[model samples]
Target: MNRRRRQWALKKNLLRAAVLSFAVSCASNAAFADDEHRGRDDDHSGRHPKVEHVLLVSFDGLHEQDVARCIASNACPNIALLAKAGTTYTNAHTPGLSDSFPGLAALVTGGTPKTAGLFYDVSYDRTLYAPSDTSCTGLQGWNVVFDETTGIDAMNGGALTHLDGGGGFNPQAIPHAKIDGVCKPVYPHDYLKTNTVFEVIKQKLPGARTAWADKHAWGYDWLNGPSGRGVDDLMRTEINSTDPATGTDYTDVYSHTEKFDDLHVQAIINQIDGKDSKGDATVGVPTLLGTNFQTLSVAQKAPVAKGGGYLDASFTPGPQVSAAIGYLDTSLGRMVAELKQRGLYRSTAIIVTSKHGQSPADHTKLVKNGDTLSKLLESNNYFDASGNFGQANTKSGSLNDGTGLTGTGFIQTDDVGLVWLRDQKQLAAAVKTLKDNLSCNAPGICADGPGAYILYGAPLRARFGNPAEGRTPDIIVQPNPGVIYTTSTKKDAEHGGNAPDDNHLGLVVFVPGAPGAGERVRDRVETTQVAPTILQMLGLAPKLLKAVVSEGTQPLPGCEERRF
Candidate 1:
């Protein structure tokens, strides 16, 4: 695509933050709070004269249902107490497909995936335009993975220095090869064509001390990091060299959950102490924090690591839910108590939220290659595991309309499959046959699940359609829910869909005396609005927190927009 088209696409996805009036009902149990009219907190900071400090925490995948259910069960009291103190939006949400990339983009950029150019783990960059089969190879720059799946990665880069290899790239030691992918994402913060909230903050409050921490790569999105889009401190290091002081020991020893829990708790404690061994809160400086948290990252056919399981929607319960609720609660309680002890609880504002939610692991509901669909296709000869689809009985016939296509292969599994054909012309024929034979079966294959609509032709083109692109796969097949491309049996739950439970996630704001916080607010809320809201609390101008492109409208007053 050309620059003109890309610009148009970008405009279409810009996120706008506005007070929305919506129905009072939601899947979450908490009721919506009435919007309060505007009021004033004219008090100035010691010097800044407006907003003094800000903290944002981005947990992995917590849904609105999870919040309500956990709250009722007392699985999370720290967050629950905040709900009672602040305005908790039952309707708070991420973009429809709450995948990580888009979810985090919404969190920091206030832009949708389409607008932010974010897709799944490996997405086709339309602007750069690479084919799907080159194994997505050939890059002008390194593909940066901004993740913090392991505590070691959090403290040091992906180096396992805490154990061996000096905390550098040591995928071999990882329990699973997939864990290597847990490395941080390559954020285009430096390449960002637009400004972010942090840029605005520095422009306004130059003296403020800002910080951030997370298991993910974009921890300090405030400054966006070394690349300099916007961000200050990120807990990571280079590809080689590692020592314990660099933070290699933490992730190397503990799980993502435990490591994050420990890090944040300790950070809170440091702030409370108010001394840097020099014994001076005013003399030197101490206790500055940024958003932080942890969770399982890699996804297999099944869940492993702990807190890994299939998400059965808001109504469905899973053992992992209880474990997650318990761990997160303990962590939050530690944070709050630390604040009170430090005497900063009354003046501090805590914003708690997650990047996305999870989908329960349920294979029975999935429709992949090993299922009845593939069997019927194979028997009918419409599908061939050996890629001999139109010429098995007789090799004389042309495979790609007489193109004499030579290279082809096929990978199959119960959930999804990968078919690489040599002839582009054969794509249409194969698709038609599959729909007529496989989808027409008792269970329709095309719906909202994995196999819903095929992301083929021009949609899959360029990245999939480019004639010269080496990465272009002959074919990319999508499976319905439960159906995955991987043969791993451990993956019972997943995401990457347009499901409500998947789209809606967990969110909490903890502070004393926040109105309607204990319950839910039915009014429509969004992640992009988070930055703006936080800036508002600090008494900063909307633009500083919202960023130049932010679409958030100012809240009415004490009460936000009214919900159900």
Candidate 2:
């Protein structure tokens, strides 16, 4: 075929696919709306034919390429087994912003950051107040309450209640927010603005049990939202918890974090056995049980001797990386075995994905630079005298004593950087300043700079939402591929960016007795489809989630969209 003809054909095919997808979504939505009006008489929608339980697991920092390579090499046999019995979306992706807060929100809330309102864990909100601001009393807009080094435990609300120390929320532990006109400590679950699939299940299918375990006490809280804890049982074992176990101190979620993840695995097994981890009958067999694994991500960054030493971005799994994959597969294998033993395997739908993929999959591309962005802005007097930026509190003390940024902006630097300018009018000048220093030293700009791709003006608003949207950052700085904004020795890799490895994630859906078992679909999809898919599998309306309707989320293409 001639070049013009081929191009025309491709465009025609693309348009056809888009139209088909849209048609399916509209039809599904209409069917769901009708069912909602008809009440729960036909509760068993039969959309998910054989599926009764849904298991969602995330391997943080897993890339689609890595999954194919690992499974091909037989390093991830359990995952390979799942792929053989399920459909694998080779081109699965996370929504543009790759932060875990927003990434997981897409899966559980069925929306992207635009609808979920979660840019990053430490993003800015224009309408929210700094803790020290007298206008809102003690309410802080930014979610800076996740630091574990600040003498707060990562789980049980930093105390005895599994969320708190038993007395109630620790005033000094959590970020304070004024809810319903009362200023109180902000629990981790309060950060999300949307409803989770768990909440939907609890509301729609009252007797259905749901449980989830995650690296941080608040990791799974992104889904629970403001409904106050949605999961029937939530296990919070801090990945960075130093609380010793098995004669080892938990470092991060990568190195010695397997023990912590194992606890969650055991909990899953117990939950499948129709009980909680403690052998208590508190949480009956959960209809939805899930947890995220971090071992592989850790292995990808560790030194050669420790099991991860990829030569480059080729995604060649080193011993550590390969071992991490094997370990994760084994962990998953255990859960599958338990389900089978209990005769629940055939009735379960398994979803495996990642919150974000690690960047520089080739460790050779890892670059460590100081916070040059902050240094440049601070040196230019862009910050307050104390250089507090807008931070009202740190591990040291509360900045609310009024010593922090009174008129200065805030800077969150990582693989991605968010700059919230206190003076919105200075945005033009700031953008110019950042653009000028994109390479190296330029005039007043310092030396040894990786520069940045500034996201502001029309382009920024076009990609992300409007800056005036409260939580949206005034200026976004996505550093070059190898340039991480911090010099922290803690990790050799980081996510949360537009990098190929950061957004392209592994996705597999396994439903036993389904005709598509062992089939691989090359369709490019997003994790946001996961929530609605799970809801459909559970025989519930996907639009029951507000974000699903608002964002127009669609179920996975191959699934049957039956009307309940």
Candidate 3:
């Protein structure tokens, strides 16, 4: 009887061991399944399931009307394809000046000039010293010109001639600022007042990478923001530099500009392939990567007689413009194909938009005033005795010349006028002078009925910012829609104005596998919203960006709804 009891006890112990082993095996399998599901559905810590990358492409001069017309005519099949799964914002616009510096800043920083502290590429800063004044003791106000002349070989007088802009910004051309009571050179990255999307992402998502490619190797350094290392990979292909094959500035011809744009296109492809911009190093794919195509912008700026601009007021593209648009469409198609091939199509979000749009789509309305605003101001003794309109002092004497302020102020003009006066007391007199000489025939601004107007005083302060703070323009002149304040004979249209064509942009947010048959959010949106939207898509808080918090910038519509 004792032996039987022992055998029964042994059998019960064996049965308990088997049951325990089965439960342990089942639990292990369940844990593995959970991990697999998490990998697929909770890639970004379960915050967003679809988007792991955001590719932001800026077609420099693309307009909202251009998108509509292209789609209707089937000229932009690739853009149309993206539109099929995207939310097209018809009334999107740049919040401030349409110049490239502020335009790009608005897209990445989520703020206008007021918060970003960037007015133009070549603008005036009252608190900073001139590039020549390394001691920072010569003058408090300097014409901060971060252009081609700021390139690395700028002092050698051959920066623009090289395809790489002499390997980036020249240290000599950078402006000086007084920090900690010491004079310090202010690089492009240090000039901006706000943090960028790249910086925000780096702080929030430690492992994510960011990259960008633009026209100027030097001037575009502002995109790096105050952190100075915001972009992990900033390509150095300069668009304004002379292409060796053509022996002319990239923008001098549309075809040449296309070749220049191809470099950036390839760079984007390399980034997508989990390689560095040069396609050499094996860095993982960046979370945020993009580039700007200058071909369309060059096409729009080309002289109408050379088959550029719209053929009519109905937004019809001329032969050259049409060709440029088609080239951009093809390039975009290549990127889309690359994304799909890598199985990243369902995980990537592409944002297509423009920094600013070319003005006077109506070719007949174009008025090339030929630096009339600056000349008018100069003739009125607004500049020094040497007639220097705060031109940058560079070895090449490229854009502007000598700089010594004995007279009233400096003037920067494109399609509009941005006047910065040394003496604030002359504001009223300057406004009176500008208003007194508004004529199309005279060597001054043209009057296109009620469209032309001047902004200054409290109104200008409200619209832009307080001029007393030094960076804001003392006076702003929004000329007629078709007026371009340039003397260059190469182009019929210009940007950097508040005209409908200049501010109105083509904004499309495309997410693969998104619900709905592509909605059109006609509600007006600003390019500033793009920065916040990018962060939100990454499962990161938009408020991580300082500008978003300060400006109260919201994400683009349909983003929160995951509509596209």
Candidate 4:
């Protein structure tokens, strides 16, 4: 095996060993559960109270700076209230590759992309075969697989057939994966090889109730992992839904998304009242329930003329940003009000965070270089002739119509780009081309503008994993902060890159009676730590998550003393 491959194999073995050991230890502890206590505080400090439920709220594209800006302006009073009663981590970051799937997975799975195997919502996997050559237009290489769906679902993994399975509008769906040798349809959860906090809770506390509502139904399936279905209550909503009232689709825009998020907020309120949002009382109250808000993300990308904030790092939220933040705070306040009304507020823990933050919040820095990298490689005969001329299966709506690439190997690009060459020998030529054409003198040569960086070799291997691992990209091109690889004039910003704004997120943990209320931790913390910390708060073994076991991921610092 090559050196990189050998290193990966070694790490994989060591990880397995570590996981085995942790599992054994947890099992042993379980045997003595009654003798001591499980998820119960052994500390007599009086400050540590029993934590019954954990409500995790993820705000997509919420930057720490955005929170700071909004809070200073009193736009996000609810979030500020939580921060005042808990520990806020100002230096929190998402695991590298700041996309929604991996970003949230890092929080709920307690592992980086390296351990969780969730690179991005739309990532390349060489080992897996495309459902059919006629579908993605490719057989196995560089296909966009987000849990049985394609990159076409920019909302990322809602059920294909319906919006929240609601009968309001016609269904816009993506093709289900058809792996050559695998019988199962490749749902988004299948792409995630690790266990999530929900799965861990089910295994350790079989009666624990769990629920989640997010952008797309399928993308958040990572909560269930390969178990197919695990969340007791799953509220599937499509942010891309068109208004049945006006027949207008607000797919990526914030104003319309806010309406949809309101549905989730109502669901949370109902869940707190011991009823399902669908009015199913048999479902019972969830011990863990939450949803992500997309309004801020929409505001970040909306044009100023359209009443949106500047999508830059300045953190000066404009009218739209200000309004979005206020709306979100109101939604949060509703949840809090319901919890209090139900008398559950005193026993529940609240966690506010973001799956990923958007980059280039400043509009002036926005650069829309129309897929220059793909054009550069396509001209070099790097892509197959079929499938949108070698671009990702994103633009061509045929992703569900069964007219994708007929072969494998292509370049996938957005705000971030990944290059998967057809042959191993082409690596050198590919690198040379990118390096040589990196000059910003021309419009297309280095599309990254001034300070874009190419990540490969050791740096890529360290943060991700060995490129030979099938899922890891051969080359990763992170364009300048504001450089989006699309020519679409609608979008003002994007995420899924290593830029500071994309990686940094706001994180605050609030346990009603926990000791650290009103405290702040300025230390650098990864989103992965949130999973184990939540597990710890619930009096469950943190090692239940494979990443916690494999990576020695711990709960938030100063959390152990407050855990019950």
Candidate number with greatest lDDT: 3
Least well predicted 10-residue stretch by lDDT in candidate 2: 22-31
Ordered from best to worst TM-score, the candidate numbers read 3, 4, 2, 1
Better of 3 and 4 by TM-score: 3
Full-model lDDT, candidate 1: 0.44
Task: Assess candidate 2 and give its TM-score to the true structure.
Answer: 0.82
Candidate 3, residue 400: how far the Cα is off, in Å: 7.0
Local error of candidate 3 at 324, Å?
Answer: 0.8
**What tens-digit string does per-residue lDDT give for candidate 3 at 379-445?**
7766553555465433345543223342235678888899998677788898888888888767657
Q: Write the per-residue lDDT of candidate 1 for residues 1-564, one digit (tens) a residue.
A: 689998977765552222322211111212111211111322223221222344566666676776787778877776776676655667777754455655766665555543344444332221231111123233321112223322233332233333222333222111111113332322334323345555556556656444444443332232362236354434332222233455543333224345445655565455445432212343212223454454322221225344344444333344554565567677777766665555455456666777776543332454333344444445445445444522121233411111111233222332333343434466777667556643434433333443345445676543324422422333444445554433344555456554444566677664333334355567677676665555555545555433324444443233233332
Query: Candidate 4, residue 542: CA error in Å?
Result: 1.5
Worst 10-residue stretch by lDDT in candidate 1? 170-179
**Backbone clash tally (model 3):** 2
Candidate 4 structure, TM-score to reference: 0.83
- Model 2 Cα lDDT, one tens digit per residue, 1-564: 699999999999887775443111211211222323444322245453456788999988788988899888888878887887677888888887788878888888888877787877655665544444433664344434433322243222232223221223223434445557765545556767778999888888868888888766543455566788678787655555454343434544354767767888898899989998556675578888898887887776565444564656678877777777778889999998787677776577888999998876767666666777777766655554356654444434453222333234577766777777766777888777777677633332222344336778788776667877656778887777766676676667777776677889999888654565566778888889899988887768788988889778888877646322
For model 3, what is the alpha-carbon lDDT of residue 532?
Answer: 84
User: Candidate 2 or 4, higher lDDT?
Assistant: 4
Which 10 consecutive positions of candidate 3 have the poorest summed lDDT?
A: 22-31
User: Which of the numbered candidates is closest to the native, going by highest TM-score?
Assistant: 3
What lDDT does the true structure give each of the candidates?
0.44, 0.68, 0.80, 0.70
- By TM-score, the better pick of 2 and 3 is 3
